[model samples]
Target chain A: MTTMMLVPGFDRVVELVPGERAVAIRNIPATLPVFATHFARFPVLPGVLLLESMADLAKAALGDGHWRLRTVRGVRFRHFVGPGDQVEIRVEVTGRTDQTAQVRATARVEERVVATARGLALVAAEQPWEGTQ
Target chain B: MRFHLIDRIESWTPREQITARKVTSVAEDCWRPTPAGPVLSFGLALEALCQSATWLMMLSTDYRLRAALLAVDEACAPRDVVPGDVLRTHAVVESMSDEAAVLAGLVTVGGETVLEASGILCSLMDAERLDDPADTALMGRQLLGKGAPR
Candidate 1:
């Protein structure tokens, strides 16, 4: 693949339940260079990255290249996930159509729900921006 | 880790509103390149919006508290953003409280809307302890167009 940029995709796809759902894990490194620049004294995983991880897991659950992330909604961060923390993502397909899929995803560190989000993924071939951008 | 997504602030009004820009360049930090042209990742675009919201929170609170992105109620980017395109974002305060605030905004290239979002940002603790003074001062100078911060 194109080496899933920024925050380096998920560490591994721990489990995949076909089109229904997937679970993945990523261990945040304390030495991540961004942490040094994000804040000199204190650092926390960027909230957007938390959402991105969820999206990646959702995509994994979908399987194949037929789908790609399109929109993210109702995502909320309940706690700060920092360096050395292990983020476990669980994504479930809430609904689907001929060309699109809706997923509800959550990220937890240990037993605490750190973040949650709902998103839509469009089939690669049918995505609005396919080849006409 | 320290990639500053928003290039600069074009305009500002303390807590009420603000406008910023991100200049896409070939040397930009990205995870991968594609044949589809300058595709600003959805995550990066979302972070840009969140940065603007954070700015509003900073100004509105008189720099007393640092704001963290809490939630995105809704968001969409209808088109792909390519190189040489300047992203102009305008964010406004929808509502506010001591603990958190609602922000609404859009990202446009030229005159076409590329992305739109509404979200919430929260002030969790004292800004003094959470923010780097130099970075904070730099942002202030940029918003006021005082060159490259002191």
Candidate 2:
């Protein structure tokens, strides 16, 4: 299993639509040091973290080979997701070429939409330090 | 509660523009892998843009309104930024209203545009909600920089 170094805790793959899409769940831990400083009283999860969660699921949908995000469009963040929330992330492969693929993704807390994004993902050779295991 | 996304304001023009920089540190990075070469994630770059826009909004409102990022469009990061790279972010206010403001932001390293976006920032609260307006203004001044003594 390839680990998500950029966005950790992406191991929970709930449903795989096979070759086209995937759904995963990640729990936001309240203990994140960010909460202590990000509006200490409110403690809402940063929007960037929410976006990263969706990007991680997009990577899982791509499956295999190193990839990079090239473009993200029409990202709309709705509800505020806070600590201890279990976010369900879904990603659908929209288009692809030999070197790149397009994906539309969303993050939800139950039925409430937390965020959505559409972006291009490109396959690239593993960075030399990634190691050939 | 400051996130410190922007280490220090490099330049500021009240309601018109702002430029800042943040260098990636292991303690602030989510990734820890060799060979990956200190990659800065796209999401983090976008956050830096939004943070800069937030400051522009706060300054324009005299620190009276606290804005939250409402939407991002055409956000493109053509290249990745390494750990040691100085991520310089520049934000220019396109327009502003009582409820929201539009901003054009670009992030660069060594004068090359690595990431760019057009984002909307909407005020979630204003001085009318705060008991002490001075407290908010104080923070506003801290971010906008002190004015010359009269």
Candidate 3:
């Protein structure tokens, strides 16, 4: 499977400015298995899943699926994302080097921001895992 | 497919700290296939750390409260966790109140640190609101090995 296909919560890339910025979306489905146990009575998308969405977008913005999340700084979740919500994710490259890229990311539902990561660093994997699976 | 990340609670000191373990397996849904091998996803590693911290907060509150992770001030992973690796997580309370708690956590494999996280903030709510108190108690018992093994 392609790296984008392996991204846990991402649906598709809506826009991409390679190595600069990117926007993606994920549609939360009620039938997702995680909801069954995250809270049987009340299901909300796990915060870590939201972070994964951001990391996926960060990798897209960096123009390399081989990039792996290395560090996270100042990530916060302000609102809950429930089933049927369409999360709009965006990532912008803040810094870059031959082996690493630093990014800032956000997730939103409509116009309200639900999550933000002030600093995320992605480092190239020693061996590109893509096309090998 | 179970959302409970940590497999077992090794030790806990009420309001002070907690230690837990998770044995990675190829069957996990979070496994990412790589040329090197299948490795646990970074997000799952963070979730395990958060769960460990949440367990400490819950035990400290006597199971009266449930914790929802609100912020991760800092986190870093130095190595990938692969199948058959036993992840040992240690979480310590930094500051706490009736509404929220801040903690620092680390994950190690065979005495070597694999991941480190600090300034984790979680919001506290009445446990009964999100989960049945009876079920929570039962799960706590099982995790701490005070109840029959599954």
Candidate 4:
């Protein structure tokens, strides 16, 4: 995939309890072009990319549907993720409704908490995007 | 692709606030396939706002300090941004210190609020660590259209 496809789909799902919790892992490759421009010399995964990974994992746990991120609250970047770092992303569904779902997410590297969000709200799209069917 | 998110600086009020523009393009790498359609990633949209806020902080410090996003207290994107949409972001400094600053950002499309964020904390650092002074100065000037013709 090109550098634009930033999430770099999860390599493995350790556990997934639909409507409850999900755990997944992704290994950051040293070659991602994003590392070059994010900081030409000092390379680290962008914090936004970590949030996107959490969002993607939330979608996986929520099942087949168009889940669009609506809001994020209390997100903190505690540590930097660098090349060769394996990130484990965890998401827990805190609440849900017909129109939206609320989740809390965290990312860790080698048992050290790297990033977290207290709440992420996702809205369900009524229809799938064209050509995705 | 270069990660420069803000396309241009529309206005600036020193340390108070800054308004910037971003015109999405289909050629940009940020587009991702979604169930509804390919849409601009919300993270990128947020990044744009952060970049804009960074600019404000940088200018406020006379380019002597660089800002790094540290935390987001709250953020919301109510509308999906598609390719070709022009986004206007206004970032207001809510608080600042020698080492950090908290800013609020709002993004709109055609006068409609699409995204809003508050309590964005950015840590200020020495500018030389992230970029050369001369280059950063040039970028600031270009973004403000300092030398461009009408």
Candidate 5:
């Protein structure tokens, strides 16, 4: 596989300017191997990919720390991010308390909001046994 | 090809019980290395369990599976989803109608509840035209070298 094709779910780290805001983008290329089987005419990016994009954005917003989601309710899919459309996703760390942090994120198609998610991030003592496999 | 997502579900038999499982590994992008060193993303674990439950529920039906996750209520993740953790998901179909099924899923690790979710899903088309030529032909290539579940 070429280095270009190695990014399975993510395409490129488009724009990351500092402070708590970043604009990251990924494309659902029709030629992708998953598209070959994910679906036929009405192919769409899996919700899991949406979550991943959100999480990766969180990772950037939260430069260094361990945060896990306690809840992510009401994640609505207003529209589908398909092969031809470019998913311009943005995430901003809206608020932060001692133990809890709130993030506001959105997936946009140039001007319209394709999807949006309000995520909760918490800071806790790192786990003892993490990746054992 | 068999759907690995729903492979374990073989019985079409319906009861008051249903079972599913989700395993988080390195490849799933849930694990990360911290200076304090690696952590598991609990959110991913919850989503996996939800997907597993969805796979089982959809497999029980004979419609064109175009399940859309409408909502996730009462989500709680208390601990990190470590690699060894096996999320044994259990969903008792609380309610069902002609088009949708509401499932209550519980994610457990070491036989302990780590997360719980109430999810809603729906099928695309009716059973009779489930294999319509246009539909099958379009969704067929994706299932190349594979057949429908019995």
Candidate 6:
């Protein structure tokens, strides 16, 4: 996708969880210009963006900022979220190694599961994205 | 690894969101050895359109919300889009309430719609309902400093 698609001015932050999980909340305001033109009638959040929320949760859980996804499994989407609905993201590591981890994740709205995915990723022993800066 | 580029948002009137053309080159990257041939993948095409909507909305409202595709949804590829065929992607914002928004998009070639799909994005997070604090600490530090954004 073009860099143009990346969210601008939007903010993301990680929060505390019950155990070893990490949570982050992002709010998509209704006034966003994309909606004004998405269509004359039918408008919905892009599927890729929903998938990215899963990735964002995984990124938050890994702690290390730089890692590429190797595989994704058991991904299923059930519900739809719109301007007012809050996307609740939950991600935890099912297993891990120095270089990789198996993560179990879920997206929800008000106790309802919107989507779920199992992710396999290659992680670095150290913070790789940090070195770049 | 292989990367596919999506379309751009040309303009957005009050009625509809305009998507620019998306192009995928057939060159083999270091990770992907085989050329992708003349047509681009349908999944990627739909992704490009959704990406376009996210950016357009953010730019128009001057707010940043992060999320990506949640599913394949109802995407259909009726025809092949070649390397040269400019896939013009389009989507409309159905409704926006609170912080979540929905955009439905279409990919077209020569005015004929080639693919269709939908996207749903949300804009709220509850700090109390997150995963483990220890696991989220490092990412939290990088994200919202000490106190998570309330």
Q: What is the TM-score of each candidate against the true structure?
A: 0.88, 0.83, 0.92, 0.91, 0.70, 0.43
Candidate 5 residue-wise lDDT, B1-150, digit = tens: 111232243222342335655555555544655545455555455555555555444445533353455545446666556655666666666666556666677767787777776653433334333234445433332223245533
Which one is best on DockQ? 3
Query: How many Å off is the CA of A100 in candidate 5?
Result: 2.3
Ranking by lDDT: 4, 3, 1, 2, 5, 6
Model 3 chain B scores worst on lDDT over the 10 consecutive residues at B26-35
Q: Score residue A81 of candidate 5 by CA lDDT.
A: 72
Q: What lDDT score is found at residue B15 in candidate 2?
A: 71
Per residue, candidate 1 scores C-alpha lDDT tens digits across A1-133 of 2223332377866667767888778989998877875666678888877776777667667665545567778888899888899999888988876677888998999989999886655445343444225
Q: Against the true structure, what is model 3's DockQ?
A: 0.51
lDDT of 4 by residue, B58-131 (tens): 89889998788889999999887888889999999998988999999998888877789999999988877877
**Model 6 root mean square deviation, Cα atoms:** 16.9
Report the C-alpha lDDT of model 5 over A30-122, residue by residue, as the tens digit: 775545434544555656567657766665656556555566655655676777878878878777765666777788877788777766454
CA displacement after TM-score superposition, residue A124 of candidate 4 (Å): 0.9
lDDT of 2 by residue, B94-129 (tens): 777778777888999889888988765545456435
Tell me how far the alpha carbon of residue A133 in candidate 2 is from the true structure, in angstroms, after superposition.
22
Write candidate 6's Cα lDDT for A1-133 as tens digits. 1122222222444453322466655566666454443322334444445665665556556664344443455556667666676777777877766677777778777889887765534354243221111
DockQ for all models: 0.49, 0.43, 0.51, 0.46, 0.25, 0.05
At residue A70, give the lDDT of candidate 3: 78
Worst 10 residues of 2 chain A by lDDT: A124-133
Question: lDDT of each model, Cα atoms only?
Answer: 0.73, 0.71, 0.85, 0.85, 0.56, 0.51
Candidate 3: tens digits of C-alpha lDDT, residues A88-110: 99899999998889999999999
Model 4 residue pairs with clashes: A128-B35, A129-B35, A129-B36, A129-B37
